[model samples]
Target: MSFKNYAFYDKIMLSKPVTVKGLTFISVVGITIQAYGKYGVFLWSTITPKALIVVDSSGDISFYQISNDTATSELLESITLLFAEE
Candidate 1:
């Protein structure tokens, strides 16, 4: 897989300065998927026009043409199958 952007988070900028050492993974109201590197990719669900937002390591964002949520799942499954078939 390839990435188009990078994202960073800094807690020092906040007054609270929450500290958590080591590798940490947290999912809020949505889902967060980490690729092969130190970057994160999240899926956002919207209502108006059902879209799949892909955020890469360099802060580059991409929207794919997804008909619905089910379509997104199918696409991911298909991709997995493709690799499995190999």
Candidate 2:
């Protein structure tokens, strides 16, 4: 589960469950109070040697690589801030 890029969010259609650290999550339309609802909004993310961990506003976490080729400039900036070396 190595990542080619870091983590961020964009609107993507997921047809199956994405597993991260043994946790599984499915995509949902709109926001919901449920714990596993919504996988589109990326609130925070971190990179590790094995995976890129992403957490949404709903507290749902997923592991996957973010596609840099399709990422927006704004999202790229945010991701830069998150991973910037101090």
Candidate 3:
């Protein structure tokens, strides 16, 4: 009697789904910044002339209207770090 080869009968398992909630949040914040720059530039500019339109080394543009408010400035810095290229 000859034995049949069962080596080809191995089951393939699919990979688990990855959760990108953090990435999604970052993306949303980035988009919000862009929109604010495009539409709310005038409003913010009037409130704070220290507005910044930064084009990083990667050519990514970000807008920030910073004031004497440390909390707001810190939050903006955190958002910038999030979208920064590694």
Q: Highest lDDT, which number?
A: 2
Question: Per-residue lDDT of 1-86 in model 3, one digit per residue for the tens?
Answer: 43332232221111222234322111112111111233233221112233344444454656555444435465556546655733
In model 2, residue pairs whose N, Cα or C atoms come closer than 3 Å (at least 3 residues apart or on different chains), thus clashing, are none
How do the residues 1-86 of candidate 1 rate in per-residue lDDT, one tens digit apiece?
Answer: 66553333211110112224432222111223332333666533322333344545454655464345446565555445645776
lDDT for residue 8 in candidate 3, whole number 0-100: 21
Q: Which stretches of candidate 3 lie over 4 Å from their true place?
A: 1-50, 67-86
Each model's TM-score? 0.25, 0.22, 0.20
For each candidate, the alpha-carbon lDDT, in order, equals 0.37, 0.40, 0.35
Better of 1 and 2 by lDDT: 2
Best by TM-score: 1
Order the candidates by lDDT, highest first: 2, 1, 3
Clashing pairs in 1: 5-56, 5-57, 5-58, 5-59, 5-60, 6-57, 6-58, 6-59
Q: What is the C-alpha lDDT profile of model 2 across 1-86, one tens digit per residue?
A: 33233333433233345766755654322111212214333244322222244556567765554454333444445445645643
**Model 2, C-alpha of 38: deviation from truth (Å):** 42
* Count of backbone clashes, every candidate in sequence: 8, 0, 0
lDDT of 3 at 75: 52
